[model samples]
Target: MPLQPLLALTNSEPEEVECPAPAPAPSRPLTAEEYFSEQPPEGDIGRPRHLATKVQKFKATLWLCEDYPLQLQEQIMPILDLMASMSSPHFAKLKDFIQMQLPAGFPVKIEIPLFHVLNARITFGNIFGTETPVPHVQSIEEGDRISAVIDDACFAIPPGYKDATALDDRHCGLDDEEGLLQYAIQQSLMESGTQDDQVDVWEALRGARPVTPSPRSASPNLLNSEERQLQRAIEASLASLSVGPQQAAPAPPPIEDDLQAALALSAQEHSRLESELMEEQRALDEAIRLSLLDK
Candidate 1:
């Protein structure tokens, strides 16, 4: 079947053929473990990634608002760290306490403003007379003090941001009570020093005798007024214990007896103070409840 091929008469370019691109491979859905184990996106390490997004945003807002000096910022680092590392339930409790302080129907935007007020309170609230104590996570008294501070600060916020509630007449009473208690303790220590040539309650509790300061080593001028006063009181008490050369030293009590007596006195004073504080706190709570009801 050999046949002769016909020749093309005209010169024509060969037609070009177009081929379609192949479709992309389908992506498989990740398992729960794989998704959960994935790393966060880069540059978000500073954020508390374990917390809910809302809390993260709140913390970010707080960070932006904080413009304190480096020294003060450093001083508050422990508190800030405690807050950041708090468990979800603990944080929720803290947030609830904060909310309880706010007026009803206040906008959610007030949270940041309210926090600004709170930060100011924490900055200035040196209730301990010296540097403010860093609150422990599990201390009930510390928790109550924080709540009270928040309550006071809530009232201090500008009225334009939210409706003003009646300010508690006995606001900051806990702080006042604490100051009074410290003053009483100092007074009791001074009196005890004058009555007997024994170690003061503080030194006894610490299981050490007070070292008399050398005349050459005077207190620094940098000490605050309160600290200066305390130093003077200690010096006066020490001076009263000085024995005259002519007077014979009386037979001293056993060290064990003195220590036991000091401890017992300290325990009694502590119990009394605690009872007083509890009573005052109950009164304050009732007052606050009534105030809220009136609104």
Candidate 2:
């Protein structure tokens, strides 16, 4: 009986279990340094120059993401962080920024990195929740016509910045930064056109004609290093535009002789019509006279 007890056997089979690949260590968000170090992502040939640009680019991607694609949600984090970081410097330089005395059309040349408008909204939503007032816009035409206002709590916040401190409302003698920002945007949009002369720039770029390299133009040496740098940047951009891939060279301005010929032909046609009308009037008069005589 003791020898037979050892013959008992179990039918258990080995099974392989795959556990979610350990979630890949919850990869960390790219820090600001790592992000800026790379050449900005494609389609952002020129670096982002405004706070509204993220809202512009991500508005379609953001707003409400309850069921949005995982890809878009993944894309928003770095952008959001970068926006939060960039926002601080703008606030830090508020005194100096205001002093720049930027033209009403400042948006045309300058960019507004005012604050992370979406981040502010998200933060507000999390805190104030449904109490957060969404604008009651009853009308909208363009899908891009989204508008978000930064609440009073968000003004000049030094988010993602430590060395930078926020300017106090009473201390700075200003609580109307929102008004100031809106005024600036409105004035600039009105004075400089919707994109602040961006359309003009595209028009300039797509001139429908070839551009020849111009000789270096003279500039004031009196300009400070910063001004000189800015001037060089403008010149470089213009130079690039000048050398942009050539298309048909504006169909060679109609030859002066040809323009004159066209004008002459038009004038001749006008004269002939006038003469024909006069002749018809005379013929009608003659017919009326003959009819009366016959009567």
Candidate 3:
């Protein structure tokens, strides 16, 4: 049996049936192959999107202290970030933060009072790339402070802040024998009577240059008044010997009586005797007078 539509009192004929459009088709979920194969969507292409990686160049300051407990490399990253945020004028104010961060129990007896700030400029192809040598890191003198770089690291240490062990490790004591010898030679050379020639030996022995004695330390070998007089007298005696006409030749050693008898003197000695010659001449003259008378 067909069912009749119910109508309202004032409503016209039964409301015409409203037909809905067919439902839209559902989208297919993307498969792995489709997602991977899809090309990137194009947009405005005025400039290239991929840029060359920037070359990293930056300056950093590092420090080394004698009693500083922490390795400087550990502090660099944080200190760098904090300092970079402030204006250039604010760097001096950061020293307090630096002092606070140092490890406790560090023996900081001789605080050199100033930080050695090693300013380093570094460049990199990548943060972990090979480290190339810096072209030239200028040496800057900032008031009582200086900065320097030593192979792989650049850092500063205070002027008087020597490592506690440096003296202990390197020192060797004074040389006893050498010291005593040097002292003796120095004493001898300093005496007033040391000769000028001896001065050279003393100086050579002590590894010193020959120098003229100062008035304060004049050598004793220099002639004083009395010494000068003695020197003059000796010089005069030598001169007298050299100047004498027919100075007697040095006498030979005396001949022993037994040796003299073995080698008797020749007639040459008799002729040289003045007494013997006079006797012979007188006898010859007497004979000549007697002969004349006889004639």
TM-score of 1: 0.17
**How many clashes does each candidate structure show, in the order listed?**
0, 0, 3
lDDT of 2 by residue, 113-224 (tens): 3333422122112211233554432222245343334456555546765321222232222235454343334333443445233323434667643233211111123224
lDDT of each residue in 21-115, candidate 3, tens digit only: 24432255445675567673233223323333322222223333354323334644466457746545234333333344444432222122122
Please report how far candidate 3 places residue 120 from its true position, in Å. 11
Candidate 1 vs candidate 3, TM-score winner: 1
> For model 1, which pairs clash?
none
Deviation from native of the Cα of residue 23 in model 1, angstroms: 99
Alpha-carbon deviation at 192 in model 1, angstroms: 16
* Candidate 2 least-lDDT 10 residues: 1-10
Query: Which is superior by TM-score, 2 or 3?
Result: 2
Worst 10 residues of 3 by lDDT: 1-10
Itemize residue pairs with steric clashes in candidate 3. Answer: 192-220, 192-221, 193-220
Give one digit per residue, the lDDT tens place, for model 1 in 216-271. Answer: 12323422433344444444434445767676544332333433343344445655
User: Least lDDT summed over 10 consecutive residues: which range in candidate 1?
Assistant: 1-10
